[model samples]
Target: MRTAYGVETVRATERQLMARLPEGTLMQRAAAGLAVASADLLGRVYGSRVVLLVGSGDNGGDALYAGARLARRGAGVTALLLAPERAHAGGLAALRRAGGTTVHSPAGGRAAGATEGAADRPAGGSASDPAERPAGGPAGPTAAEVLIERADLVLDGIVGIGGKGGLRPDAARLAEAAERSRAAVIAVDLPSGVDADTGQVHGAAIRADLTVTFGTHKPGLLIDPARDFAGTVRLVDIGLDLPEEPALEALQHADVARLLPVPGPESDKYRRGVVGIAAGSARYPGAAVLAVAGALHGGAGAVRYVGPAGDAVLARFPETLVSDLGPAKAGRVQSWVVGPGAGDDAATVAQVLEADVPVLIDADGLRLADRDTVRARTALTLMTPHAGEAAALLGVARAEVEGARLSAVRELAARYRATVLLKGSTTLVAAEEGAVRVNATGTSWLATAGSGDVLSGLAGSLLAAGLPARDAGSVAAYLHGLAGRYAADGAPVGAQDVAKAIARAWRDVRD
Candidate 1:
């Protein structure tokens, strides 16, 4: 499992570690790692031009120290200080000592890079100073913008993790310039202007090609919106003694493999467990077929499907035990998956809710299932909803749920007193407590029609096989995502195609 700590926990851990170590030791450690990552990105640093968007915080220090390291390696490094008066004094000294010049932008005007060791140089150097500008360089663009535009690499240190509500206007301009530039942008710790704890990007933020995080993974680095801004993430261990419990956890292949249910030789079909899928109305029969298709590969011994679409399901999967009876009389099913094109069948949703076995609610079930009944259930309940369904349940706008997925999933899980799997660009499974599991295997290709139906059946089967709600949801999402990848292979694919690819995903996980 890849774990991520909340900002408070990370800060607390950093404080404790810093108290024991020599002053500035921790920053140096972070700087060394940042420099290494920066150097690796600037392959052949000898002639590379590196630009640092320096802020007033420790992040700026990290960039400055890293810039010094690059400067020492024969890279032409320039620091564009957003707040020159408040820049890290030690870092500025280090950069100057390493032969890197600083460009201070005051009032958003053009400024030339100050000459090294020029004690009397104005805050913004004269544009006529040939020492800073390239000989006869284009005159219109600010020196800061020119430096950013022409650099081989740009380090975003405009804001730190603690800063919120997006970047200041001046800093925003630098970020915009970096985005327009051809240089590969590297953000220190995480992309600036994203909420570290919630993965929310409120306004203008840095979009980096790579984010070098220190000590531990921030919640923002793993979740979306903010996660999208952060390109590839690289974790550098600065040796802070973090707590065991993480705010968020992402299951890797090994973790998913361990959680997957594998039957023993003595196990019979009945012993393997049966999943009951109470879904599909006459209006939408394909939903049933797709659900059953996914359930068949979901480690369950058998699938008992009860709905109006029995004939449609039987036509595709003859192995499914189809019945017209309601979910209550669907025989002895270990678990039940309700909804998925169910169309307003509130009574059936209630019947499955009344059952003692674990239940998974998805699609129309999210709308039909009563909240109080779900909250009162003694058995484990897993509710899978895309952003829209989740928004309806919470009575909030879909955009709100999409922007703050971590909080929305957790809130839904708490309100329903059930586990929730919020599906989108990044799928998340959250219970009332413990670390929220984020599914990273998902692809945008899985956004096709009936995709959630397939996920519902797979997770329901896992529940029937006796996996806890969290584990069932997490494992199902992992396999479903991998299956989507296999089915699509970078092309458009149907939900059935994704369901058909589950077996390959299962085998791949075990191996």
Candidate 2:
């Protein structure tokens, strides 16, 4: 599992490391990694023109040191100091020693060329002056635009962890110029102007093609909004011994494979696990068929269907055992999946909830639930709510859930004391333990009518197969997303096709 920590945790870890290590040690490690990554971006560092957007803090210091490294290797490096005097003194000297040139803003009248040992020329230079030289002026768009457009790469050192949300006016203008240029942008630590902890973009943020983060991953780089701005994240180990407060996490393929339920050789059909599904009605019998289809493909040994659509399920699946009684009387089942197209059938939902087995509530079932009754249930419960359904459950607007998806999912889980899966562009699974996982698979084409119903049934089957409630929810999401991508293959696919694709997805995972 890949873990991400909040800004506070990162800061504390950095402080601890700084107290134990030599002065400037961590910054040197960060600068070295930044230089190597920059070289990769430029393909050939030698003779490459590089521009550094120097700010007033350690962020600018990091960029200056990195520019010095590149300059020593024969690259033409220019540092556009947003705050020349306030910049890191040690870093400035290092850059000068490496033959890096510095240009002050036009507002600060040109001083003697310290490193070159020559008197400073006038701003924009006279006609006799070399055309390759930089003429800094106010460090605004015009100056940054010219430098960025001419360089092969632009290193964004505008703001670091010390800064707050959004860019300062000067930094924003420089970022905009960098965006318009052809150069590949590299952000130090993170894309500037984004909230490191919350992943919220206060105003405009620099979009980097590559971000070289130090020590560990930040929560903003893993979650949305801010994550969208951070292109490809690369962590540089700065030797900080961190604690275990991870704000977010993403599951890799190996983690999913480990969580998947694989039946043992001694396991019989009954021991493998059985899933009972309470779904469909006379008005929407296809919902039952689709739900049962997903359960059959999902790792369950047998699926028992109970509802008005029993006939429809049996007609489609043939193998599913149909029962007239509700889920509570559906004989024996390891897990129960309630509500798909059941409409507002409170009686069926109540009966399903009364079952002794693990239960997964979805769709119309989420609407029929009483908060007290759901909270009182002793069995492990998994609630799968799309943004709209989640909005209704939380008594908040749908737009609110969509805006802060991570918080919404966690709130649902904590309030109900269950595992909550918030489905959307990024499927989020939250548990009562405050653990959350983001599913980064699936295509937009999976947005069919009954797709969610299929997911509900698949999760229920996984629960029956002996996976814990949280693992079942997350694994089902992974498989469902992979299956959706497979079924679509760049074309539109219906709900039934998605259900059929689950088998292929399971096989792929096993292989």
Candidate 3:
């Protein structure tokens, strides 16, 4: 499992580490890692044009220090100071000592190459000093823009993890310029203008090709909107002791493999576990077929299905035990999966809720399941809904749910007193409390019709196999996402294709 912490936790931990270490030791370690990553991205440091967008905080310090290292290696480094006076004094000196030059932004009331020395401005020299001028003298408003466009790489330090509400007008212009440039943009720590804690982008933000984060992964780097802004993420260990609890967690192949169910030597059909699927109507019998297709490959020993689409399900998966007596009389089942295609079947949803076993709810079932009844259930309840469905449950717009997926999933879990799996660009599974699990193994091609029905059945099967509500939902999401990738393979695929690939995904995980 990969863990991420919020900004407050990171800052607190940093303070503790800083207290024990020498004054500038932490900064040096961060700068060393940043320099190495930058060098790797550049491929060749000598003779490269590197531009640093310097702000007024430690974020700028990291960029400046890293730029200094590159300068020592023969790169023509230029620090485009957005705040000349406020830039890190020690970092500025280091860059100067290593043959790097400084350029103030046009809005800074000085033209390009207004060299500021160690403790003074080139010893009685000023912006117009001929002794310390750049190759071309004093370019105008377009100076900063031209510099960034011509550079081989641009380090975005306009804002850091603490920045919120997006970029200011001047910084936004620089970001736009960088976007137009062919430079490989590397954001320091995080892309500016995104909420480091919530992963929300309010306004203009930097689009980085690679983001080198220090200490630990920030929640924003793992979540969306902000995640979309952050391209490839590389974590550099600065060695800070973090608390055990994390703000969020993402399950990798090893984590999912450990959570998978393995049958014992004495296991029989009933001993392994039976999943009961209550789904589909005459109008949407394919939902039942697809759900059963997924359940059959889900590690469940047997499947018992109850709904009006019994014939269609039996035709596709003859192994399924079909019944028309509803979920109540549907023999014995370790867990129940409700609400894929059963349009307006409130009675069936209610009946499944009353059962003493765990229940997995999805699709039209989200609309039909009674909120009070779900909360009152003694057994675990897992609800899976896409952005639109989750929006309806939260009484908000779909865009709202998509923008703040973490908050929306957590709110739903708390309100319903159940585990929620909010499916989108980043699939999130959250219980009322604890770390939210995120899954990014899915492909965009997984957006086909009846795809969610397959996920519901898979999760229900895991629940039946005795995984807790959170683990069942998270593991199901991981497998379903991996299956989607294998089935799609860079092209379009149907829900059945995804279902058939679950076994392949299972093997991939186990091995």
Pick the lDDT winner.
3
Shift in Å, residue 97, candidate 1: 0.8
Q: What is the C-alpha lDDT of each candidate?
A: 0.86, 0.81, 0.86
How does residue 161 of candidate 3 score in lDDT?
Answer: 71
- The pairs that clash in candidate 3 are none
Model 3 bad stretches (over 4 Å): 106-141
- TM-scores, all candidates, are 0.94, 0.87, 0.94
Worst 10 residues of 3 by lDDT: 116-125
lDDT (10s digit) by residue, model 2, range 69-111: 9999999988777656555666777787898877653323211
Backbone clash pairs in model 1 (N, Cα, C under 3 Å; residues 3+ apart or in different chains), count: 0
User: What would you estimate as the lDDT of candidate 1?
Assistant: 0.86
lDDT of 3 by residue, 1-511 (tens): 8999988898888888887887777788888999999999999999999999877667778898999999999999998877676677778888889998887664342111212221111111134322223322344436778889999999987667777676776678788889999999999999988888888888788999999999899999988888989999999999989999999899999999999999999998788889999999999999999888888889899999999999999899999999999899989999999999999999999999999999999998999998999999889999999999999999999999988888999999999999999998789999978459888889899999989999998999999999999999999999999999999999999999999999999999999
Error of 3 at 392 (Å): 0.6
Ranking by lDDT: 3, 1, 2
lDDT of 1 by residue, 77-178 (tens): 998776666667778888888999887653232111211111111122233323233312235567688788999999987667776777766677678889
- Clashing residue pairs for model 2: 106-137, 106-138
